[model samples]
Each structure stands twice: as C-alpha cells, then as structure tokens.
Target chain A: MTNAERKRPGRPPGPSDTRDRILAVARELFARNGIDKTSIRAIAAQADVDPALVHHYFGTKTQLFAAAIHIPIDPMDVIGPLKKVPVEDIGRTLPSLLLPLWDSEAGKGFIATLRSLLAGNDPSLVRSFLQEVIAKEVGSRVDDPPGSGRLRVQFVASQLVGVVMARYILELEPFKSLPVEQIVDTIAPNLQRYLTGELPGLS
Target chain B: MTNAERKRPGRPPGPSDTRDRILAVARELFARNGIDKTSIRAIAAQADVDPALVHHYFGTKTQLFAAAIHIPIDPMDVIGPLKKVPVEDIGRTLPSLLLPLWDSEAGKGFIATLRSLLAGNDPSLVRSFLQEVIAKEVGSRVDDPPGSGRLRVQFVASQLVGVVMARYILELEPFKSLPVEQIVDTIAPNLQRYLTGELPGLS
Candidate 1:
C-alpha cells in the first residue's frame, strides 16, 4: 500500500466503490424506464456522481448497461462481426459466436444472472435488452417485409432463449452435454427460417 | 349448502380437503423422487388418507401429478391425442395442441405456478415433469436410429420451453401477441425438424 493510504484508514469511497454505485443506479433506472429512456446523466445523478465519471468508469451507456447486467463482454463484440456477415449466414454465425461465449466461464455469470432475473419475475431489464438492443441491431437487417423485422427477431429470441433455458437452466440430459457445434448446425436452419423465411401472418 | 354440512361449522376435513392434501403430498414426493419412483399409495400415506381415496380423487398417478403441478388438464389430455398422431406430424400437431392450452384461461394458473417455481430456483418439479412424463411419452415415439429418442425429445423441449419463456414470462412483443395459429404454423416446421429431421452428431 502507498504510505499515504496506509497512514489514513477508513477513507472515503475509492474508484471501485464509485463504479459500483453507478452500476447499481444504472440497473435500477434501466430496469424501470428501459435502456432508451434511461440516460447516463440520469444514472449519474442517481448515483450522486458526475456524468463524466460514469462514462470514464463504464465507457458508453450500452457498455454501462452490459456491466450492470454482469455480461462479461460487450455486446458489440458479437454484434460488430454480425454486421459484416451476409444475412443468409447470420443464423449459423450468430449461434456460432454466441454458443462459445455462453459455454465459457464468463457465461456462467450471465446464466446465473438470467436465472435470478427470471426467478424474481421481473424481466424488464432483459426485455429492454432484447427489444431495444438485439431487436434493433439484428431485427433491422432481417426486416424482409419492412414491418416484420421485430417479430422475426423476437421469434429468433424465443428459440435462443429456449436454448439457454434448456442447456443452462433446465440442464436436460444430452441436450445439456451435446457439442456446441452440433447445436449450432441443428438450429441454424430453423433460426435462418425465422430470420428470412416466409410466414403465415407476415406480409 | 346441505343441511348436514350447515349444522357444523368447521367439521373434520371434507372430500375436497382430502383431495387437496393428497395433491400437496403428491407434489412434494413427485418433486423429490420423480414420477417413476413416487407412488399414489405413498402420497396417500403421507397425506394420511387411504390409497383408494387418492386413486378415487385423482384417478391415476400421472393425473395426480398434473393436479399437483396445477396443469389444469391431465397430461393425457395432450399425450393421449399425441399417441394417435403419426410421428411424421408430431411437430406440427404438438404445438397446435399446446399453443391453445397455454393461451387459455386455465393456462394462466399453470403459467403463474411455473413463474413461482422458477423464482424459487427449485426446478426439480418442472424438470421431473419434463424428463419423466413428457420425455417418456414423446421420446419413446421419436426414438429413431435406436437410442436417439430422448435426446431428440429434449431438443424439442428446449424450443417448446423457450416459446413458453418468450410468450408468458418475457412477454416479448409481437411474439407475445402473435395469433395462436400463427405461432403454431411458424414453429411447427422447426419442431418437426427436431423430431424427425436429420441432425448432426446424432447418428
């Protein structure tokens, strides 16, 4: 420890403490008002810190949101590569990218957080993430009929969320232990259909 | 009110009381020991009722389990029809039957029970229901290539469970509001693929 710190115990909040306060406030506001409606400045004010401090600690609002939710990596890490890929390949590529991440040690936290969130019967945070973030990013690209984009993405979300539940939360046999590649290959076609296939109700 | 009943204000347990006690006991035992091992006699014994009374009240072990889980209808209500459906059409037929039930008034109770169960983080009951009851009835029918039945059913379960999460729990827009028939049509093909379609690493 620095001599100055060693000499003075019981000091005021440090960098980590300030960062944690910002995250707690961000989670509350985001859950209450959703991502679009909740602002960094609002979160900063709630945390009793400067907006600049919030940004410096967590980068951007989305990044802050990720941190608040306990996702180990930025969503852009996955969404960025997805932008470059052909729409036809998104079904395969999306799961290919995500399955590995979800299977990693970091994924345990995400899964645990999801379970707790669902258990609490409050899904606003997750819903906001899906609607505002995922739907906007992937949904816009696959909006084949223009207005059908969000529904299509939501369908995709249904399947993906199911996979998470079955594989992680429910922990069903064989499905839980199956190779990730096998799952990616199997669901890719179905997910592709949701993304691009003709449907009964959609235009 | 019957005259005999009106004469007494809090008499000994009535027939409905006996039934409720049996159901509560059944849920605990079934959740702890699973369907194959938990017996109607055991549940009756725990409830301090006769095995005959348990049978008379709930009809069968599976029926008791259905009531215990608040499923409203006997699982046989779905499973019986499924037994008649050709394996080739199960994917479409399965969702066609389930979507309506899930969207029904009775389904609300089941969904609420599920939410509370999940929130409590004790999925043993749900897991048991899926593994022993649904998997046995459906998996056995789809067990193509010798031993692949259970796994196939589980994969299908992942998707179906995901649909429940999306529609009821997360209540994702559009996906949540989509017509029963629309969802049935959209997911049928995918579910059918899981049942009978060629999958990687399965052979």
Candidate 2:
C-alpha cells in the first residue's frame, strides 16, 4: 500500500505526531488544574488515547511535566555550562549563563512555567523541580559539608526565583529598568554568597 | 421618628456601614478582575450605590485599592519599630519585625493581599504601595547619597516579596520549614547590603 493511500485521515499521522498531541493535551490540563492534581489517566482520556500510551510516551508524571514545559534550551543544557567553571567560580559563571537566557526570547516559556509554579496550585512539582532537578544537578558539582549543598542550592534557587519574580514577573522598577549586565553584576555576588558563604546564624 | 422607626430595612444602617459595604464590594471585584480592570462605576454598581459615592468616600481608585487591601497592622506600624534601631541595624530589625507578623495570625490577611498583588492583575497597586508607602517611609529614615535611598528601598521590597513568595506562597522546602528566626538571620545581611552597602554595579 502507498503511504498516502494507507494513511488514516482522522488519526495522527505517526507515533511522533501522537506523542505531540498527548503532550499538548497534558500541558492544557496541567496548566488548568496544576501538576499534582493532573493525572496521567486524565491526560490520556482527554487526549483520547489509552492510558498506557501516556505511560509509554512519558514514563512518569515528572518526565511528562518536564516534556510539557520543555523549552528548546533544556534546563540541563543551561546547567551544563556551569560544569566547566571551577567550583568556586560557579557563582559568577551561573548568572552569566542564566541571566542571558532569561533575558532572551526563550525565557518567556520559563517565565510562564515559573508563574504556573508560583500560582501555588501544585507545590509538589515545584518542590521536585527544585530539590530533584536543580539541587541535585548543582549540588553534585559543589563540594559542601554533607547536607549543606542542598541548603546552598535552595538559597541559590530562592535568590534566582526572587530576582525573576521582581525583575520579570512583577516588573519592579529600577530592577525592571536596569540593563541586564548591571543586573548580572548586582546579583552575581549575592548568588555567590548563597552558593558558598557561611550560614551566619545557623547552629 | 424614633431611631428604630427611622431605620429602613433596605438602607444601610449608617454612613460607615455604606462605606464598609462599598469597600467590601471593591475588594471582591479587585480580587476577581484586579485593580486596573475594576472601575469605580463597577464597584459602585456592585455595591448598589452611586459612582460618586465611591469617589466621595475613597477619593480615587488608588485610594480605593489601598483601602481594600489594608491589613489591621499598617505598613507604617511595621516600619515604626525600625526607627528605634540604628540605620545600620535596620536590615536586621526590619525582618525581625516583619517575619513575626507574617508568621502570626494577622499575617493571613497580608498573605491574601499579597496573593492578590502577585496575581499580576493590578501591578499599579503593588508599585504604589511599594514606592509611595514602603520606599517613602524607609527612605525617609535612611541617609543615602541622593536618589539611592529609593533604590535601596526598592531592593529591600524585592527581597521581602521574594522571601514571602517562596516561604509562604510557593512553600519551597527548607524555606518553608525554616524557623522565622533563622530566616531573619539568613536574609538580614542581604537586606542590609541593599539598604546601606554601595551598589556594586550601576551606570
């Protein structure tokens, strides 16, 4: 049978197409109901496919969410550049890699993803992304006193998230109006401190 | 007529009652649609009163928004304690005062109000409150090089907003679980730098 002759008009053309359709449906549901409340079965049901198909395409909910919000520049890709820098210089190198991406056109997707996270509907996803993805990746590279790496990563995340919220989302002026380079300069030292500085009051 | 006889069933009991009713309606509309989109006419109509009455009582839309989100403990009251501390100690004192309030029962109202602000429906209200109230009060006390005090105040606002978002709204771990005192200790120095330290980079 010829390719055109054998094709089903109503069905997605191929497996890749089917996967894309499932992802689109998943994105819509996740955005509306949040990641925690959105179930794979519900996504498959909404996508008009078998639940097994979702399981086949995306092995877990976290992977599915990562796919749904996937930008061209994967977060791993963003973090990859950090690996090249000396551990001590990671603080300075971190902002140079991150700030430009956020300022770029690609950052809009991230901004939206962040807004969804901050909407406080599904905190589990935010926690997972922070602890599992971000902390794991950044912490693995840095040598710290056992559990301190996670704390450092968390502080780093807090500062970065806060900057994004104020500068991009909230559009707080001075921050909003400042040149990107200036912002990088102003914030890099703070990020550095969070990454490696001593906790002044923690026992 | 006796006071009881003079009271009409449909009418508000007193001027203050009518004002309260209007404020309540304004709050609902602002929460639903945001401050910028919600009009005085809409608020008045929702409250079953005249637009002029809204204008008369609130004076302006900004004033009306300020009224709607007003917590029992004013921002001024929160800043009042900072006055007793030396300007150098303001950063430490500021969070010590604010975090306890947020951790208290009264902070619930502030949390709700903050959620409304973060919803991005009416940034003007957030900007006004930050600039006119917070910056003005804090700036008045801090002796900085000309124009830098506002910058300092804004930076302080950004940090506070970010901390509230992570700790309260997003509930990011460690930040969510950390004791208020630890958080104050951790963040106080950063606030101090923003408030008093030479800004590292600016044109």
Lowest-sum lDDT 10-residue window in model 1 chain A: A1-10
Q: Could you list the CA RMSD of all candidates, in the order they appear? A: 5.3, 7.7
DockQ (C-alpha based) per candidate is 0.58, 0.37
Cα lDDT tens digits for candidate 2, B1-203: 34464366776567787788898888777756665578899999988899998999877776677677766554556666776778999889888998888888988877776665555555555665666666777877764676777777877777787788778876777778888888788888888888888775622
User: Which residue pairs come into collision in candidate 2?
Assistant: none
- Model 1 C-alpha RMSD to native: 5.3
Residue-by-residue lDDT tens digits, candidate 1, B1-203 = 45566458778757776676677788889879999999888888899988998888889888888888888898899999999999999999999999899999989867877666656556777889889888889999988877888888887888888899899888889788888989999999999999998977778
* TM-score of every candidate relative to the true structure: 0.90, 0.74
What shift in Å separates residue B35 of candidate 2 from its native position after superposition? 13
Assign candidate 2 its CAPRI class.
acceptable
lDDT on C-alpha atoms for all candidate structures: 0.86, 0.74
